[model samples]
Target: MASQPIKSDGGSSSYYLIPNGARDLLDLIEHKRMEFGIGNIFKACYRLGEKDGTSKRYDLNKIIFFAQRELARLPKDA
Candidate 1:
């Protein structure tokens, strides 16, 4: 399935995609990181897992790793 696009306040050009069931976790991490800082990504994941029962099954570290890797691949201008 095609990945879903994530909206960012930065601009239309600043966006990312989340594939599979990791969308919510990634979205929460991205939003929290932008609002708080990179240090909060793991905290956000833990909080989301506690609040959202379905998120517990996902491997937060793996998701963050892959997401960051994919985001890094985007053009610097993007």
Candidate 2:
């Protein structure tokens, strides 16, 4: 399934999808550090329980995927 924009709850989807429109969001997504997945992870977490039916499940799954990516990107202790 395709990922929904952060503003999917209300405002026009176009606003968020536009690179120059939602600058902060795009910046977070484009960040290339150890915390690259932070934006998506937090967005997914915020969506949890906020929506009904499939949307809720989608958010949960999204969180899991981002979390895994985050964990893999982090250094593990021996």
Best by lDDT: 2
RMSD of each: 11.1, 11.2
lDDT of 1 by residue, 1-78 (tens): 115666567855434544345555556465434433343455545575665554654547545765686578779997
Error of 2 at 46 (Å): 1.3
Q: Which residue segments of model 2 deviate by more than 4 Å?
A: 1-34, 49-54
Clashing pairs in 1: none
Supply candidate 1's per-residue lDDT for 55.
65
Taking all chains together, each candidate's TM-score versus the true structure is: 0.28, 0.46
Error of 2 at 45 (Å): 1.4
- Judged by TM-score, which candidate is best? 2
Cα error, candidate 1, residue 7 (Å): 11
